[model samples]
Target: MKRIKWVLGLSLVGVLAVSGTAYALGSGASGMMGQTPQFIRTQNQVGISKMGYGYGMMGNYASSNGAAGYGGNGGGCGGVNNGESYSMMGGPYNAASLGINLTDGQVTTDDQALSLAKAYVQVLNQDLSIDEIHEFNDSYEVELNESKTSNKAFEFLIYKNGGYISSEMGPNAMWNTQYGHMNGRNSGNPGKPTVTAEQASKTAQDYVNQQMGTGYSIEQPEVAPGYYEFMILKDGKDFAELDINGYAGQVWFENWHGPMIKTINNGSTTK
Candidate 1:
């Protein structure tokens, strides 16, 4: 009986070796003998809705087996091992890496309106001393009426020596107007005489021309009774204008005034 048992054992060992060889050789029966009994059900099982690893069958197998949480579907984070991955939360790293240096008079096209406004403020501060300037933060509600032919005007106060002495808008200040009157007012009447708008315009133009050379010309004449508007025209075009108040009324010149004149001309040429 012992001999028979030993023969049976030897036979079993030989069969196992043959089966292993057959499996290695790609035999179906041999493969089945070599495979774990649980493999077909576990490895072939479908994973949860979404999950996978490293772009391979083994990863999918792992996912299906529920060994990998979330099945490595990558979801919103995109898929891992699905080529290059990027972070939505992390902004452009290169942009953050660069340092920005800002200084005065640094011209940039970005934020142009804001830059111009800042430049205007800078010019004011630089041209006028702290004692000669008073800044007020104010807001205006502008109502535009198409039927009314009126000038929508504003006044900016100018302080000198701690006193509010004058007001100006685009270089047409009260003091400038007064100076024009002192120099350009008709000598004929100190009490009761009429002065023409043309005469006032001529006077203002002559003053500007004399001071700034022949490059200036009158673009708009002051049309009001006592006020005169004169513009400095350059290259056959109006660059900046000034309004003069004759005794009481204000004069206005259109589109021919301020430091922006040169900048505007330069832009035109470039365009």
Candidate 2:
């Protein structure tokens, strides 16, 4: 087995903020920073649901039977956010690897909701209570915290439609639609992308080569409220993901797939 040291849900959780590092690519002195045209559309669903390897709970998924990234929005942790896998290094992973395309049932379950809470606490090996469970459109949001002292800081989501109960665990990350608020109030506006898809793709390619020792093919970037989501593929299959700021070409989020490897967060927070 390979040494797959990871933080887990680093998907949705670890990559939230933008890097303030300014690239001097304006004139020939700094180089050419191209314009970012329309957003790059992709076929694969890359939601940081699992906001994070929140994918995390981290499930006991196998690298060989690797699942695609999945996640729901709202707030929470991944290794990408919270903790490590419960059984992954052992066996038996979750079946819920659904990304933002979680359109299955409109059902609800007290047991299902509670299970998510339990899973989270189990992973952290901490004591927690079901703080709250509310219905949000097609998904059920679950909240949890330490059993007694009232620490409502950690939160996650559970999705269900019809009778299909799912947590979509894996190294899935999600872009929290709730990014623009603080203490129950709006914080500020998100920055718009200054670079075009072509420009961002070139930056992403350069990043891939720097990280993986070789360049890989990438699709156009998805324009969210603030960041650009790039779905990287190899041999026409989902291999990795990259999130960069359109305004500054900052790579915000990233995750790779392998024969049972977990996600990694290389201290690339804030930017």
Candidate 3:
């Protein structure tokens, strides 16, 4: 139900790093590029089944129409629809082939989706790790490491047939949700924060002062996924709402939502 209103923009160089070698991903990335269609996993609760390239944990058969709507809007997050790397499998794959009719932006199971998404992240940036993943109406959205600012992080989506839909790199920069603070958002771990509510509040206050120049007030930073979304107030006047990277402390001021809005893939978030 919550929505992020910013774009995480990874530099062009960062995107091209993985985009150039679109096919070389996963376990056999190097050798399997032109040789054969990369096969996905068929696993169950116990673990990955010996049987290779098959259905996922959820019954392999379900009726889901392909409808994609992912990538939330938040300052510093970059997103692409129908991204490059069409399909991980070289060829011969469809919802029917896998015994399911998948709706875009939704996932039946996390492990099944992660098995497929992890490969993509690994190839793009070995240092990066999948921090979260969720099923949307028509696609699976995944976010990577929080080591840097949100704008500098890596995130992407995986299509039904195991194809790389789109990728987001380098979110602009914003404060992380300072959960637990008296004035913080309701949902978030308040303890051991990398950037505490006090820090974020100060960050907001400092930014507002610098931008507006004297006599600016703040309404407390609220947690939104990777960053905090809050408003800067100047005599009840809306100076701006800023989103800042919870860690790196990068920032930007932009919030324009289209017909469909997306947010962090914190289990419940969708596009």
Candidate topping lDDT? 3
What order do you get sorting by TM-score, best first? 2, 3, 1
Candidate 3 residue lDDT tens string, 135-215: 444455565654454432433555543343443222311123321111122245544335555555655565555444665
lDDT of 2: 0.36
- For lDDT, candidate 1 versus 2, the one ahead is 2
In angstroms, how far off is 210's CA in candidate 2?
Answer: 2.2
Q: With candidate 1 superimposed using the best TM-score fit, by how many Å does residue 245's alpha carbon deviate from the native?
A: 2.5
What's the TM-score of each model vs. the native? Answer: 0.28, 0.35, 0.31
lDDT of 2 by residue, 166-222 (tens): 232211222222222221211254444466666667776765554444335577765
Q: For all the candidates, what are their Cα RMSDs to the real structure?
A: 41.8, 16.9, 21.5
Model 1: lDDT equals 0.26
Every candidate's lDDT: 0.26, 0.36, 0.38
Please give the ranking of all candidate structures by lDDT, highest first, separated by commas.
3, 2, 1
lDDT of 1 by residue, 1-271 (tens): 0010111222211312221100001111222222221112222212112222211211122433344321111112111122121221221211112222223322233233222323333333322111111121111011111123432222222111111112232222111322112222233333321334554455456445543456566665533223444545666654544554444222222221122222222122210
Candidate 3: worst 10 consecutive residues by lDDT?
16-25
When summed lDDT is taken over every stretch of 10 residues in candidate 1, the lowest stretch is: 19-28
